[model samples]
Every structure is written in structure tokens, then in C-alpha cells.
Target: MRAELFDPRTEAVPAEWDKFLRDEGAPAAWDAGALAAVAWTSLRTVLLGVVADGGQAVALFCGDFGSPRRRNPVYSPVGGPGRPGVYFSRILMGFDEGFLFATHLDHAGRVAARRAFERALKARLGRRCLGVVYQNVSAAALPVMRTAARLCRPVSPNTVLVNRWQSMEEYFAGLPRDRRRRLRRTYADVDADSGLRVGAGVPAVDPVEAARLEQLTRLKHLSPGEVLVPLPSLYFERLNHRDGVRYFVHTDPATGALLSFDLSFEHAAGLVTTVTGSAAGAATGRGLYWDLYLREIEYAIERGVPRLEFGKGLVELKARFGCVTVPQYAVAAPL
Candidate 1:
């Protein structure tokens, strides 16, 4: 088996690309159409391809070799071990690294396919790129990366809430006593704050306002001395209307000022909170972050979805909301 590369933007996108992803139980973000739509806006060198055997495509992979500075750390021109940049495969929507081989492949086949894909990728751009970095890799994909990538390490751990409860109270009851009290107190405080108004769906914000919102979100999330890759205001506009996505915006009731926004993606099973941002000032009262988290749970219970995905970090707070933690990792190799 060998890896064959194709450009989804330039070549005829195969019908099987979507079908393969679906069959593998891939998330909505991994859908070829969605990735193709937004992939180009940030990445310059994109690699979309499949693992083929006897001319039949059996597995698929898509990635890019570029420094998405805003979303990632700064890098040097020649990237590698101790180098600046990286060859990355970022899964869109979900904001994870993108890497999916056919789940049906037996152990040996899976290993071979990974090796071939890496070999082919290296031949194409490995010489000039830093190294391959596959972010947020799932446990099932770990074995294949054993031989394909060199260093493997866990990054932030993910936390999720399986939406099996019938009511918001039932959901809250699952948390420990301390957590339950904390959430109730926080929720009550936010509810009593007259200046705050939290609502689901996109708020009425013009392009300039949207840009400011994105900037605020980036600044709030940035670490010390980190450079943020600026997401275009248009990206937010497009995401606000994307199918299966729900936007929860927090505002000041009196002045209609945008306080915070939560963007989550919906699927057959449940919803995953993808993007979030808030003004630093909102940190003081009404607990904008907790408010958004509570709103998500309330929304989930009302809708009766089976799960709510809260990506990595805020373990203690998310745990208080009854979100179970799931580990997330990155697999990389020195080119």
C-alpha cells in the first residue's frame, strides 16, 4: 500500500472522502467539505490524500506545512528538532490536528499505511519543513504513529459531559456536593446580575464589532510572550452561519456591549464547545465563563442530546459541571 496525494481544492473531490470519514465515525469538523472551505484561509501548503492499495483508496489523510503563527507558536524558516516551524495537519471546526486512517485496517495495514503516508509527506516537504506535528491525536491512532512519528506527548487533557440526563436538575445532581453548590451559587450570581444578558445564537454585531470580539478573545487566551495568529473577522461571520453550529453570545443589557461568545458544533450525538472568548473585565461578576458553561448544559438538556464536548483544560471547573476528562496528545517526528 502507498499514500497518494491529491489537492481537494484543485482536484475533483472524491465522493468517498466524505463517505470514508463518515464510516470511520469521524466528527463533523473532519468532514471534507468543511475543512476544504476554511483550510485555505489559514494554511498555504495543504496536503490532501488517501492511502491506496492496488489502486483502491482505503485510508485518507490531510495536512499542511505552514506556520499558522496566530494559532501556534512562532517558528524558524527551517523547521525541525530545535527548529522554528512545523508540518501540521489541523482538523477544522473541532480545532484538533487532522489525521484519519481507515479504522478497518488491521494492525499491520494500519502501520504500513502510516509509514507510507509519512514517507510520501517527507518526500514532498519534509526536507524544507520542521517536522510533522499531529495534534490532539486519538488513542486509536497512536499505534500507527509509533513508527511514523518520533516524539509523542500528551498536551492538555479534554473534558466532556455525556448528555444522558433528562433535566438540568438531574444533570446537576450528578456532580459532587461541593461542585453542585458552587455551580448553583455561580449560576445564581450570574442570573442576579442585571447588567448581563446571555443568549443563544449570533448577536447583532457589525464587521468592526466582530473583529474587536475576536481580538479580545485572542488576547484573553494568549499566554505570556505568545504571538496570536489573527483570525479574520470574516471567519467569525462564516462560522456564525455554518450548519450545525450554535453561537452563544453574552452581552451588556443596558448598552448592548458584547461581553463574550461561545461557539459550539452540533452532531448526531451531541455538541462540542469549540471556540470561546470574553472581555477580561467580565471576569469580575456574573461569571461570564461559568455562565456560558451553564448555558451550554441547559441548552444540551433541553435539546436532549446524548453528549456535550468541552475541549481540554479547566479541569476543576469543568469537573464541577460534571464534565469527564479525556486525554489529548500530539504525535510528532523530527524531519
Candidate 2:
């Protein structure tokens, strides 16, 4: 086995990386299609593990060896303990799953490929920068990541998902009577509120307005000294592409105030809400967050998405909406 490094800034993604990802049934974001969109952006480089047989890549990890930036504890910006090393996810993207492998690889083969990749990364980037971090791993990927890493567990930041529901009605009916009543009232209130409208599209929002909305949203989750990363305006603008990414914007019709927004990605037969924001007062006694969840559920049910992944936060609330809780672990492994 051999490891290969590709600097997206200066090199093209090897065909083997593409072939392996496809063979593994990796998500589109892990493929060249999405990687191409990010390779030129803020990303630093990518690492790949190749089989000895024909130099075909079987394992892949993408990240950057950049300065440590302030990231929320809820989401570590990169892979290490704030040192310069490769972070698996891009700055703009939140944790999906980490470390993609060819589907054909069994447990032993998967572990071997990871070890090989780690050694190559250490040789190329030096021992001080030899740590890999994977975030929001699923049950299927947990064992593989644990094969060569240290796992960190957090309490409330677990990903919540709803599966096996046939329709919105079926989903709503399964909720507790009180929760169901509250959701119905909230939906009605949002509908009747002439000042507010839920607009669906992939439009790029004004940066200033986006910042305002983000700030308001973060207030709900702020710890005393936590600093959240600032998302660039270009990041939102880039979502305008025809890919499965979509945004639902909440706005005030009269004042054009950006009340709230949700960014959802269609991946692996599921709808994942990657990010969301709401103005401080916008959600006051309005149940705006729950409404957003309901909207996502309806969208998923209509589109026949087998599951709706409401990414990490407010577990009890999400559970009340009929979403099962799943523990999300971040694994750190030293090269």
C-alpha cells in the first residue's frame, strides 16, 4: 500500500480517488464534483491511500494544514487540538461523515488502508502535524474510524433523525398529543402571520443580513467565551448551484427582514439540514425552529427521502418531533 498527496491548488484529483469513492458509494460531496467546487476555495490539500495491486486509491481524506482558527466547542473547526494539521472538513462545510473508503474493503482492509494513509501523511507533513479528526460519524462508520483514532463524545450535540415514516401525517400522528397540538398551532400561526412568509429557493442572501440572522441564532446556544466561525458571503452564494443543496428563507414581507433560514442537502437518500439560523426575536414564542423541522419533514416525505437528518442540537425537542437520537462522535488519531 502507498499513500499519495494532492494539493488541490496545484494538482488535479487522481482518477483513482474518484473511482474509489464511487466504488464505495460515497456521498457526492466526497466526489470530484463537489471537491472541485471546494478544492480551489479555502481547502489546503487532500490525502489518499492506494492499493499496492494497481495503484488504485481505496481510502480518501481531505483537509488543510492551516493556522488554528477560533471554532465553537460544539464543532471543532479542524481535526486537532487547535494546532496546525489537516482538518477533514472544509471551513464552510459542517461535519458530514469523515473518512471515505471503497465499499469492497472489509474491516481488516479498511483498517490497513487508514494506517497506511496516516503514515504517508506523517512523512509528508511532519510528525507534529500528524492528527486526523472526523466529526458526526454514523454507526456504520464508527468502527472504521475507531480502528486508528481516539473518540470524543459530547452530550447534547448528537445528530437527530426520523426514519420509516411514510408521510407527514404519519409522522405528526406519532408525536405526543401535546407536541402534535403545539406544532399544529405553530404552523397555523406562521401561516396567519401576514408579516412572515416561508420562501423556498436557492437565493444568496445579503452578507450583512446573514450575519444578523446568524448572530440571533447563536444567541440561543452561546456559552460565555465561545467564538463561532464567521461564514463568508461567497459560501452562501456558492449554494446557488443546481446541486441538491437548497435553502428555505424566512422573511418579513413588509420590512424585508431576514427572520430565519435553513440550509438542507440531499445526500444518500436522505435530507440533512446542514445549517440553520433565526433572528433573536423571530423565534420568540413563535416556535419557528419546530416549524422549520416540520417543513423539512414535509419536504422529505414529499420527495420520498427515506430519512430526515436534523443535524446536532436540541435532542429532546427533535425527539418530540419523532426524530430518533443518534450519538455523534469526533475521533482524533495521531499519525
Worst 10 residues of 2 by lDDT: 70-79
Q: After superposing candidate 2, which stretches have Cα over 4 Å from the reference?
A: 6-57, 63-92, 147-157, 200-208, 254-257
RMSD of each: 4.6, 5.0
Q: TM-score of the candidate numbered 1? A: 0.76
The true-versus-predicted C-alpha distance at residue 140 of model 2, in Å, is 2.2
Model 2, residue 221: distance off in Å is 3.2
For candidate 1, write residues 152-254 as lDDT tens digits. 8887877888877888788778878888888888777877878888786443344345456667866866787666555556555545455566777777899
TM-score for each model: 0.76, 0.76
Best by lDDT: 1
RMSD of 2: 5.0
Clashing pairs in 2: 24-103
* Predicted candidate 2 versus true structure: per-residue lDDT over 87-182, tens digit per residue: 553322555565666767798887777677677667766754657766666667677778533855543354556566787678778878998888
